[model samples]
Target chain A: SQTIHQWPATLVQPVGSPLSLECTVEGTSNPNLYWYRQAAGRGLQLLFYSVGIGQISSEVPQNLSASRPQDRQFILSSKKLLLSDSGFYLCAWSRGNTNTEAFFGQGTRLTVV
Target chain B: AQTVTQSQPEMSVQEAETVTLSCTYDTSESDYYLFWYKQPPSRQMILVIRQEAYKQQNATENRFSVNFQKAAKSFSLKISDSQLGDAAMYFCALGETSGSRLTFGEGTQLTVNP
Candidate 1:
């Protein structure tokens, strides 16, 4: 069984503060990882995805960036946060290149103050 | 680029009744997959059902099923004998067979009434 862990279930950060959200997967190797953000009452939008370590593909231009430091460790970071950056962020992983089903974490609810 | 559309922003159904949520998608790929995910108040996304583009037969899983019309590029989810637990946000997603990326719809908030 594979599990994804996302930390700081709820975060309150001041504007211009640095931010880092981490996600990790267990029981799988070389899995595909993705980061998605959902605004209040809005659908989720894909922010970044990584197929392997040190490789990331961003779907949108925004105030955030993602990195895959380890095989199963992914981090979302921002140098300076903005009020508009607050939202619910989710981390997901798919088994392999051919697996269509993705498993998601509990998600992080960040509130920028 | 692939896009998914869920026309209904909200829907309601009586308990034990049947409700269908509509979904349509635009994609240039010939091989792909469609999925319906349920997100309850807890907000944990769970995969309800999935359909492959090359499959002709509709996919069903217990009370949840999908009507996949590949030619029309439409996929709808039908929930039979709806229960209170069914009340949640349902999302339609499109996945390419060659890639692991998924495109999600706007989502439909389903409210099951007793």
Candidate 2:
């Protein structure tokens, strides 16, 4: 069975501060990793997705960036945060095949003050 | 381009009753999959039910089932004997077999009344 782990379930960060949210999947290899953000009372928006290590695709332009350092390790980062950046961030992984059913992790609630 | 539409922004149902959530999708591909994911307050997406485009029979899982209309481009989720735990955000998604990418709808907030 594969499991996804996301850190800092909740965060209160000041404006202009840096942000780092990590997500890792165990028991899966070469999986497709994805980053999604959901605003208050809104659906999850696809932010970034990576098919392989060192490859990332941005769906919407914003202050954040995603990186896949290892095969199963994905990180969402921002150098300087904006107030609008506050939202629920989600990490998901798929088997990277034709029939893709993504499994999600417990999202990170980020509040920028 | 594939698009999913969950027109009802919110819906409510009484406990022990039936509730049907509507979903419509547009896709050019013939082979595909549709799914219903439940997101509770915890924010993790739980797969409620899934339907394959080619299947004529609806998919069911205990209290949950799907009415998959391939010709109509519709896949609706029906929850029977609803419970309080069923209150959550329901997202309808379409998966294209060629790309394996899922396109999600805006979601419907289902409130189960006790």
Candidate 3:
């Protein structure tokens, strides 16, 4: 079975601070990875997706960035966080091929004050 | 660019009753996929059902099923004998044939009344 793990289930960051969220997948290799953010009572917003290591596509321009440092390890980072950056961050993995359902991680909730 | 639409912002159903959430999408590609995801209070995005564009038969999983109308570009989810745990926000998503990215709808919150 495939599973995804995300760290710092919850975080409280001050404005203008650096941000780093990690997501790792097990039981799968070369899977597609994606980063999404959801505000309270809002829909999931696609931030970035990666097909392979060092390859990423940004869907919406924002204060966040994503990286695939390893085959199953994805990281979301920001040099400086903004108030608008506060939201629930989710990591998802798919079979790389199209038309495949995506599996999501536990998710990280970031609160900026 | 493909777009997903969930016309219903919220819906309510009695326990043990059947409820259907509506979803529609717009896409120019002949080959694509539609999906319904459930987000409970915990906020975990769980796949409920999926429908392939080329398939004629709708997809079903246990108590959940989807009505896939390829020509109408409509994909609706039906939950039979709704349970208390079924109270959550449902989202409709669209994925293109060439990309792995998914475009999500605004979501419809389903409330199960006792």
Candidate 4:
């Protein structure tokens, strides 16, 4: 069975600080990874998705960026965080095939103060 | 671009009763997929059911089932004998045939009353 691990489970960051969230998947190779953010009382918003290493696609333009450094490792980073950047971030992985469903991690809750 | 809609912001059902959550989607592509995801208080997104565009039969998983109307572009979920554990935020999602990304609706919060 495949599992996705995301950390830190929760974080409190001051405004204008940098941000880094990591997601790693075990037991799967060459999986499609995605980054999503959900604001309080809002729906999930797609931030970025990577089909392979070094390939990232941005769905919405914002301060956050995503990178796939390794086949099973994906990182979401920001040089400087904004107050609006605070939300619950989720990492998901899916088999490259079309019929496979996406599996989600526990998610990281970031509070920017 | 494909879009998903869940008009019901919230719904309530009595325990052991049946409740249906409505979902509608707009897509130009004839071949696509529709999914219902459950987000409990724990905030983990779990796949409840999925329907393929080409399939006419609805998808069912234990107590959960989907009503897939390809021509009407409507996909609804029916929970039979609802349980307290069924209370959660349900989201309707649409995924295109060519992309891995899924477009989700605003979600409907379902509460099971005793």
TM-scores (chain A) of the candidates: 0.97, 0.98, 0.97, 0.97
Candidate 4 lDDT over residue span B4-85, tens digit each: 8899999999999999999999999888888899999989999998888998999999999999988899999999999999
- Measured over all alpha carbons after superposition, the RMSD of each candidate to the real structure, in angstroms, is 0.7, 1.2, 0.8, 0.8
lDDT of 3 by residue, B16-109 (tens): 9999999989988999888999999988899999888999999999999999999899999999999999999999999887888889999999
lDDT (tens digit, per residue) of candidate 1 on A33-100 = 99999987667899999999999999999999999999999999999999999999999998777857
Query: Model 3 over residues A26-104: C-alpha lDDT tens digits?
Result: 9988999999999888888999999999999999998888899899999999999999999999999999765588899
Docking class of 1: medium
lDDT of 4 at A58: 99
Q: Where does candidate 4 stray beyond 4 Å?
A: none
Residues B14-113 of candidate 2: C-alpha lDDT, one tens digit per residue: 9999999999999999999899999998888998888888789999999999989899998999999999999999999898788746788999999998
Give lDDT: candidate 3, residue B23: 92
Q: Candidate 2 chain A, which ten residues in sequence have the lowest lDDT sum?
A: A93-102
The residue-level lDDT of candidate 1 at A41 comes to 64
Model 2, C-alpha of B19: deviation from truth (Å)? 0.7
If you superpose only chain B onto the true chain B, what TM-score does each candidate give?
0.98, 0.98, 0.98, 0.98
- Each prediction's DockQ against the real complex: 0.72, 0.64, 0.77, 0.65
Q: Give stretches of model 1 more than 4 Å off.
A: none
